[model samples]
Target: MPDEHDQDEEPELELTSALVPFFVITNGRALPSDQQYERTALVTALKGTSAAARTLSPEAQAIVDLVAHGFLSVAEVAGHTHLPLGIVRILLAQLEESGLVLVRKPVPRAEPTDRELLGDVLAGLKSKFGA
Candidate 1:
């Protein structure tokens, strides 16, 4: 027998049926066997976003709403929506195809260093403070 607390927990979302139509509609055919989307890619809603939002599925709409606030990575969307990462990727690809969302690769950040670019910070600090 399951614990009472277990019964109170929300049911897990099922995507197989719910996402099938989205995949078909977006692809204009069956789901692809192999589609690749970068998990770290950032998504942003396009301009005139309200009209575009109206054309999306409820799931896709939710994703658009989240993206409108700010750019969000693919993994972030999956986490926020509680959808599987693969589903989010497919949905994002559809949105991207329609120009409703813009997907961008995350910019690589420069590594931090202890060395200063111009000169030693201590020399400048000593000169300014006169200690």
Candidate 2:
């Protein structure tokens, strides 16, 4: 038989956080006005822009806060906030429009076959190997 105390006790209630959908967070917007914020693009908060951030949603504000101190790549921001890349791009565009942040595209990669550079490398290798 169960104890009298056990029978009188109520089951404990478990609390859980509500799940918010991506559309809700992004206000049903699919893409940003421009495609400037690629995954590797660097972003930083504009100085003295905290006042403007007050009007942003929680997710947008989080992005501004993350970049306030320094620069962070779009991919880094997504990873840090656990937000999807597409969502991050949208939020960043909004922040940039509000003058809350600055975005810098990554430097373009060098051409794979710079004739002069490759020739120099070949000459160095031939001299080193006596070929």
Candidate 3:
């Protein structure tokens, strides 16, 4: 006799959530120094190898690489690729929408809650006392 398990079944209950973290988006261009070096090496290798470069459309790949390395801005990528600035902005937006990358913007400060006000006061005191 053989025993069978139904591996095809999946749980259907929906676990709902509304919480979003403050860092839902991060600046993708802030690579550490070591990572930048690694990325540069990889870029050089890709540029040097014809077969490897052919596997990826080098034009698009270059844009992606530079953006990932945080070494190029959308405007810079556009200028290098000879693409329009609007087109570059659109492509960056697409990357963000696809979750392939994140772009950080300054968070607007919220009005102080009681807890936040108290915390700020304590922080001020600590700074004044060099604590």
lDDT of each: 0.75, 0.86, 0.46
What are the TM-scores, per candidate, against the unseen true structure? 0.56, 0.69, 0.33
- Which candidate has the highest lDDT of all? 2
Q: Candidates 1 and 2: which is better by lDDT?
A: 2
Which residue ranges in model 3 land beyond 4 Å of their true spot? Answer: 1-60, 106-131
Q: What lDDT would candidate 1 get against the real structure? A: 0.75
RMSD from true fold, candidate 3: 17.4
Instruction: Please state every model's RMSD to the true fold in angstroms.
Output: 11.0, 7.9, 17.4
Model 3 C-alpha lDDT per residue in residues 12-78, reported as the tens digit of each score: 4455753432122222223233322221122111233334333433444555666554445445566
State the lDDT of candidate 2 residue by residue for 1-131, as single tens digits.
54555554685444565478877888887686445788889999999987877888999989999999999999999999999899899888778878899999899888688899989999999999989
Note the clash tally of each candidate. Answer: 0, 0, 1
Total clashes in model 2, counting residue pairs 3 or more apart in sequence or in different chains:
0
| lDDT (Cα, tens digit) per residue for candidate 1, span 22-129 | 455344533322324577878888878788578677788999899986799888998998877777887887787788889887666787866774467778888999
Weakest lDDT window of 10 consecutive positions for candidate 1: 26-35
Model 2 TM-score is: 0.69
